[model samples]
Target: MISSRSFVAISFAVVPFVFFACAKGSSLPGGGGGAGGEGGDEWSGPAQSSSSSGGMGGSGGMGASSSSASSGASSSSGGSGGGGSGPLPIVLLRIGDGVTTLSSAAAPVSLEWRLTDGSATPGAPGTTSMPQVISGSNYQLTLSGTASSEGHLSLSANGKYVFLAGYAADVGTLNVSTQIVSRVVGRVDASGNVNTSTLLTGAFNGSNVRGATSSDGTSIWVSGNSTTTGGIHYTTLGSSSPTQILSNPLNTRCVHASGGQLYATSGAGTFVNVFTVGAGLPTSTGQTATSLPGLPTLGASPYGFVVLDLSAAIAGPDTLYVADDRSPANGGGIQKWTFDGASWSLAATWNDGTAGVRGLAATPWGGGVRIVATTAENNENRVLTLFDDGSAFPEIVIATIAPLNTVFRGVAFAPQ
Candidate 1:
């Protein structure tokens, strides 16, 4: 059973207030680059045929729908997608962990990657595997190794490089030689050929990793237990040595950067830690920090969290979405949160049935929102649940997606 003590200990371990004060004390430095051929065998020549020709409207499924549509419509649509000006790139996250096992012995963990068509329907409706063809173009990548734990894959606004975190004892980057096609144009079929390579290494920070991307995709935020100091720290894009943003010796599982702000979860605390970013990003070293209201009471610790700032939505600027995976045995369920332009607070709470939520990702679908989350282990299948802004949770299986030996860890989509 999940214990209250363990929950409380985990939540408060990485207190944001402690880190805000700590962030003021000292500073750390770091830099990053890839080791393969100078940009290696990246797509060099002219543009290949367009990968996505149909457009965003073609890719369907509640997950890829835009957030502007009505929630009722969003909840029922199986293959509807949010319209986009052009094709978008899809980012896949491989989540797993590593350890130096005994010589002649094998590693204890496995590598897994979760694939999401940048705008939903990177494949076809009712199809377990990604569609092989799209607008007379082919898509492929080189992939290797087993995903163990917490890692990241970040996509740019223009979709050039998909930054991957926590892999092969270091961070890696998947540089698409050409523009990524949207699901509407074509779907990604699993050939298990996605390329794998490292970008940064050396005493990397964090454990049970959590990461966030900047609006421009120029920067990212990662929070977790640090390998170098064993304390929780936040790292930015392109930096190997993190700026030790927080270190109360607590273990953090998730980190997010949005709307010029940073948020983190201790998975064992009552408060959602917050940080304010300056012009530099992951580089800013967080000049300021604050706490969000409506965190679980001490007994009901909030473990996993996600944040989305829909400033672009015609709705309002101060809107934020957060989820709390609670164990009644430990005290919570599927919870919701919101933030005005200035302060943050809770919105609603609901039970996601038997299995609780572990991770969350949001995509805009025609005036509404589509969310994907993982449930605690069930039978043979690890439950992947989908939620529309106004409805109950639904099970949407991503069966037969590639890189066989690898498991799906996290999901991310390119901005429309």
Candidate 2:
């Protein structure tokens, strides 16, 4: 549970950038569009939801229990009892007030959760893990579609709503749910009723959107691709149509915002495109994009990027981490670049010595920063690996594990 003091602190912390962004699209990734993934080439921010329903069990609760089923499970997201059991795999992890939620995707559907026990880390000492039954509580809500390949459950700093990504061959889904209890004690009895889910729009809406990210929790920034007619569009949550910002047709992939200035990755091949937010895409949206000039000889082409404030930087304003998955033949690695507002130069390039590193995020753990990446053969059978910042070139693995059986596609992390 977030004490009043913590809530006030987080809100004050966000005051600096609250006015920098102008929301344009339908409901942000989260109901109110909770923020995540900020910076150029990054996802901008995480899902922010605004609905408040109490903690895991009720007001002042201490744990959260949630399950993202594969395709078709049960009405209540929590798995039922009477199945083979063994060591539970920690699927989804999120840090919320007094409660933390973890999912076990394997075996006879089950949700094992633990009370915070006042430990900052719920899975750590003095905590206890208990099985949450599907029919036991009114707070648990079952996901109807396939679990997200990204395997993340984003909770707002306020702990009002939960956001997750789910995708299928023909169906890709995103969700925002209310957290009614502290832990997944079991399924909320059917009679214990509550409206727990609200669906977000899909990528395959056939609307010519190339790439997109939630600018806030309620508005979406969708880029236009070769097939899309609208260059970029913004819609408010619950709105029926999008407001067009540009109409040029370009193969836009990456999207990020640094003030009112929006940046994208464009070009026939691969490049970074810069644009003014709410104005339109760059004039060179057709074929050219700003180049990083001094990038070291990275083996793979840079696929994605995120900007972070390295409190360790001597002079640079921010550091850029790019997913440079050289070719499979050459082995891929993530490269770092330093930016001082005007000039950008390479900082450190670490090769994982394996294949490639994609789905990168700057994770805050153990009071420090950890660079996380998902590695696999074309994103399949993926595993997440964590490394400390400024520790090495590629990354030094501290923890590694498989998230889903399918190819791991994307990864996102909320404040632990």
Candidate 3:
């Protein structure tokens, strides 16, 4: 049950990027820095290798030995130091018009990259354009074994690869009645090159696959909407077969993994479903569905959301932000909630008379957290808005970018 806006078929020209003949015999880049252990060493770049991984190292070529040395330093220093100063982390936005034409000439999904310096203050408005675009022809083919439409995207913890989940129709036909929609999972390396062997294809109850996330490097959790076959599904990094984990009859809009929990929000549910993910998979027991207090009952329309484990921020940890896509005039906005040992309570709310917040992401900024959300405007222009978690009412709109005629679906931060 993909949204009409998300599954619409459109005709548009492809955006161009410098194309390099994909290199041969290239090995995948090492997974980037590990999630820094609690009070242990901070996360560092992957150990460098002697052979070229592929393309421009593009913020991914630091030495592996350097990672080892940094870990040693952290062990000796008792983990007192903060994440070291380095190049800004890369922020990747999944871009697509959702056009699924099977004609010989059809544009595929693409990715745009932005560099965040980790210091943008609240209330400071700025506009930044993404400089790099990786087209579907370049990466999707390698990841999915076919040029399929891209839907939701997630970055692996180590930052080595981006996991994508979406649906694809058979090629060389335009008959909607004859189209076969199938779910696909794929990976792209730091160099923006796709890893062909990692392409995973299957079906999810005859519905377009939607949300996806990877908590650990081994397995990925995906969700879709189908009465018979949809719910939450999972598969390992190298496996094409998927095991349906949760078979609830809900239209899951997005899924995220953080702090040992897997959170999923449905476009038709009042509460966000939570599960304990152990060993990279959700445990079958102890699943809880929670909702924000004081919010009007959302009969069936909770859209995109983000979970912030801001243990590093001065603000209390276990913060969650859910985008309510009701019309902006009817209280459509983001509801901020915090877990107070026992349950989640509303902390704050912010919106500016504009609804359609469909994608959310967070990254470290100014020693705190910067939240980026996509607002789908009525005019079909998608607006990217930034906010500082430390701010109050009218939460600081640090930046906004409206990409022309595109509906931005998901946003992710690639570690520096």
lDDT digits (tens) for residues 1-416 of candidate 2: 22211111111110100000110110111100011111211121210111111012111211111111111101111111111121111212211111112221211111112111100223422211112223222223222111221222322222222223221111111221111111111111111112212222332122122234443334444443324332444444334344545443233434443223344433223333222343323222332234444443322344334544554545422556655444323424445566765666655444323345444444333333334444433212223232333432211221232222223323333212
| Model 1 TM-score, all chains together | 0.51
Q: How close is every model to the real structure, measured as TM-score? A: 0.51, 0.46, 0.61
**lDDT score for residue 276 of model 3:** 28
> Residue 411 in model 3: shift from native, Å?
0.6
- Which is superior by lDDT, 2 or 3? 3
Question: Which candidate tops TM-score?
Answer: 3
Among the numbered candidates, top lDDT falls to 3
Per-model clash counts, in order, read 49, 54, 4
lDDT of 3 by residue, 1-416 (tens): 01111112222222222111112001111000111111111111110000100111111111001101110000010110122232233334433233431222212345555432222222221122211223443222211111111244556545565555643432222321112444555555554544323323543443445556665556777765555455667777656676766655334556655545566665444443332233334735333444334433444244456555555433333666665554443434455666765566666544433343555555444344444455543213232333333434222221224233333445555421
lDDT of candidates 1 onward, in order: 0.30, 0.29, 0.39
lDDT of candidate 1 over 1-416, digit per residue (tens): 11111111111111110000000000000000111111111323210001111122121122211122111111111221223223323333322122221111111122222222223334322112221222123221111222122333333223232233332321132321111211010111232222222122322222223333333434444444433432233443434454454554234444544334445554334333332333324453324333454444354333334444444533332334433344423323334555655556655443322334444445444333444444332111132323334433222322222222233433344322
What RMSD, rounded to one decimal, does every model reach? 16.0, 17.7, 16.0
TM-score of 2: 0.46
